[model samples]
Target: MLRKIIHIDMDAFYASIEQRDNPEYRGKPVAVGYGGKRGVVAAASYEARQYGVHSAMASVTALRKCPHLIFVMPRFEVYKTVSNQIMQIFREYTDKVEPLSLDEAFLDVTENKKVMEFATQIAKEIKQKIHCQTRLTASAGVSYNKFLAKIASDYNKPNGLYVITPEKAEKFLEKLGIEKFFGVGRVTAHRMHELGIRNGFDLKQHSEKELVHHFGKAGALYHQFARGIDEREVESEYVRKSLGAEETFAEDLHELVDLLRALDDIAREVHRRAEKRGFLAKTVTLKIKYADFAVVTRSRTVVNYLRTYDQLFDIGKELLLQVDDIEERKIRLMGLTLKNAGTDQVVLTNQPLQLTLEFKE
Candidate 1:
């Protein structure tokens, strides 16, 4: 059976909310984030984006791009309330609604409660309901599957709706850039470009076997995407395997003291989240990203569950010290994670021998 999928994404979510609440911010360049030397822009309004100010860009850089840009601190509690409002609207149509974030979700409406024959109509109604309840706008994409639906949602953005039928999928994909494909990041896009695969048509020229030889498991996915095919389901329930917190620094830290300080903050955050969720884990992992974008992680599994901030910090410190030549490399990011013991989830670490010690009663 052909499944009807709809992907909905809010327009400049945080920034838009700020504008809606504050009339003075309307029609002006607004950024939602802390405006400090070390802060980063979490969201940029359309007006700010016109000035080349965008999310994740340095706060100082954003100021340089748009001198009149107004910065507003994020109100996460209010955002969560709005998220619940939109999710309720989604539930009215179908139960198979998968939320990707606070502002975006995918809905499988093949068998809907409204008995609507057209997916496009459902997308339109959902968008209307969201705006009516939240005074906010959303963009929606409707298609036969998830991949094309997600792409279609972005095609006409900022209070827009787009539909990609089965007949138009292949031709549309052939004209799409490789970078526009799902899961194709900067590094992968560069490699694809080097291999003369700049667009979907170029990607289609290679056989599945040839693609797999060049890109491994992801290559198989690329081949299918190029042919406008994706079999992945809309998973309504998401199972979290680990709890972690990470921070990207405004300036690289080269000193051990600075790294330890950052690690302490991250450890506290992970512990607080774990306690709130009632998540218990026996393993602690320390992750580091260098200035050159090389990532490395080290993990330690203890005899008992990690239940204290002190225990998390101690294990993270130990793992950090085991890293090779840490002083020689400038660290750009630091993170701490607590993983559930006895899970098959892959962990990238420097430890060669992983031994599990157990006591027999």
Candidate 2:
């Protein structure tokens, strides 16, 4: 069967929430994060992007780009609520939904409730429902597989939909930027460029063996991606990959004592979530944003899954201390998430779809 996959991503998730709640923020440049000396933009409205502001970028740089940028501290509780709303909408169609983050997810609808002939219609309906229910716009991608669906979703911005068919897949990928390829990060893109592999076409020139020799396990995946082939099954269930909490203070934190307390709070929250979910996370990750806007994460994966609050907090504390510029940097937010060892959910669907009656056990 030709698998039907759709990728849905909310447009400017955090910033959209801000715009939704505050009518004044509409059509204006707004950023979600502290605009302090050590601050970073957690999310930027479309207007802010026009001024060169972006998420994960330093507030200082964003300010330099747009002095009039309006900054609002993040309200994670609200974001989580919105996320739940969208997730519920997704479940109405298919059980095979894989969430990429709070605002993005992939749905496999080959066998769905609507059982619609065309995935495009399903995508359209989902988008419409989101707008009707949440008053927010979402971009959607419809294609045969995951990678292409994801690419299609980003093809249009703000509020858009794009579809890639099998025949058009190769051509569409050829024009994609190296940075746009899945799993190709800043470091990987640079290395690919150094090897004269700039785009999908360039990536196709190398043999699987050559790529494996050069890039290890990722090389094999890239070899297939170059040809628009992704055989990865859509996992219906997945263990909690990370457990962490974060807070954006109303006031910027500039002292070590205060920072420790925040970190402790976040770590405890992470530990609690992990314990509740029975997560086997070996890696403890700490993410921080300075008032100056520079954001960084330090993580150390232990041999065993960390379950206790003490273990998680101790590692997080060590990581916090490693940031030598902490005192000089005014912190606006701190986040901790646990990365569990790899595990995939097993689905049960191969059984016959017929009804059976039994008289005796």
Candidate 3:
């Protein structure tokens, strides 16, 4: 049976919230983040986007692009409150809701509580309720699967609704650029372009085996996506396998001292999240991304669950030191992750085993 999925994404969530609370910021270009030298934009208003200012862009660069851009600090508590309100609205229609972030989620409404025959109607009602309650606009997409629904949500922005029916899915994907495909990041897109795979049609020309040879495991996903087929289901109860936090710097750090300082911040963030969720793990993983986009990771499993910030930071430092020729690389991003030890034990126990027969051989 075809699933009825709806993806809801708020338009410029933080920035819009700022504009709604402060009328002075309504018509002007606004950015939500710190305005310091190393600060990055967390969100940008539509007005700021016109000046090429976007989220994750450096604050200094954003100011250079639009000198009049106003910066507002994020109010996460208020955002969470609004998120809860919207999520409650989603539950009124369907219990199968998967939140991607505070501002976006996917809902499986094939068997909706409202018993609505049309997914589009549910999407419109959800958007209307969000506007009435929060005074903020959201964009919604209705389709038969998660991938197409997400894409459709972004088709029109800032209080927009779009639907991609089963009949329209193929043509919609065929003309879509490879860069717009989910999971095709900058590195993968460049490789695909080199292989003459610029769009969905180009991608469909390659077989699954050919794609896998060039792109590894993700190649199979691309092949399926090109045909407008995704078998992934909407998981309502998400089980987190790991908890981690990462930060990207506006300027690359070359010195060990600077890297350690950045690692301290990331470690604290991971610890805070772990404590908040009551999550315990026996493995610590450190991820480093160099200025040139090369990435490396080091991990260590301990006998005991990590329960303190000191433990996390110490393990992360040891992992950092294990990297070869670290001084030669300019680091742009650093992250720390914690994995549950029991999960590994379960995998080992489930593995199939073969017995050797020396006499038969």
Candidate 4:
């Protein structure tokens, strides 16, 4: 059956909120961060991004790029309030709403309440209503499936909406770069590039078995993704997946004993956080970062929920043996993660009928 999925992403979410609240910040290169020597940018305004300032970039570096950049510390509480407001807006039209973060979500409106004949009209209405309620801008993308919907949302950005029909899906993916494919991060991108795969078209050149041989389990996903096909459902109801902690060390620790100490700390931290949040997971993932900033991760699925410190540490220790460069290269960071396979509760609310908060000047 043809599905109607819409991906909505806010434009410069944190930065835009700051701009909206502070008149002086308008049209300026504003950033949200600690703004200290050791600080990094949590988010950058459109103006700041123009200066090459981006999220997670060191604040000192962002300042070098734009000497006049203004930093505003993150108000996560405020952001959460805004997120709740937006989620309310999404629930008005459909019960199937999946929030990716504070700024993005997917809506399975195939069986929506409004009975709207076209998803484009629904997208337009949602955009309009968001503006009405929040005085913020949002973009929407409509497609037959989740993958295409996400790509379509990015088709036009910052208050723009784009739709991709089934007929247009193949052509749409054809033009996309490998970097744009979901889950294809830096390391994967590099691997694909080495294999002469630069975009969706190039990826289609390889068969499923061939991709699997090279990339393990992720290759089967590659073959389908290359063909612009994703069978995953629009999961509006999702459980909290992974909860973990990581730290970037200022100096690389070359000693195995030192790395283990750091790993123990990270594991303890993850265990504490998970216990506090009541997060239960059957899988544990250990991530390592080398002095060169290169990263590797090893994960194992256990039969029981990872709640105790011993389990976290033991799995992490076992995985450490797989790394050959622990003593040769400096270990910059280590982390532990726990992933939940399922969830039980779903949030339901009203979807916005329009997109503007008020009339524009």
Compute each candidate's TM-score over C-alphas: 0.88, 0.80, 0.86, 0.79
Candidate 3 structure quality by residue, lDDT tens digits, 1-361: 8999999999998899999999999989999988877677889999999999999898999999999999997787787778888888999999888887788989999999999999999999999999999999999999999999999999999799999999999999999999989999999999999999999999999999999999999999999999888889887765556778788776789899988988888888788877876677899988898988799999999998888999999999999999998888899878888886454222211111111100100
Error of 3 at 35 (Å): 1.4
RMSD in Å for candidate 2, one decimal? 9.1
lDDT of 4: 0.81
**Residue 222 lDDT in model 2?**
93
lDDT of 4 by residue, 60-101 (tens): 899999999999987777887888898888888888887777
Give the runs in model 3 whose Cα sits over 4 Å from its true position.
246-266, 288-296, 324-334, 340-361
Pitting candidate 1 against candidate 2, the one with the higher lDDT is 1
* Global lDDT scores for all candidate models: 0.86, 0.83, 0.86, 0.81
Predicted structure 2: lDDT: 0.83
**lDDT, candidate 3, at 200:** 91
Give the clash count for each candidate: 0, 14, 0, 17
lDDT (tens digit, per residue) of candidate 1 on 5-62:
9999999988999999999999999998888776778899999999999988989999
- Model 4 regions lying over 4 Å from their true place: 247-272, 282-336, 339-361
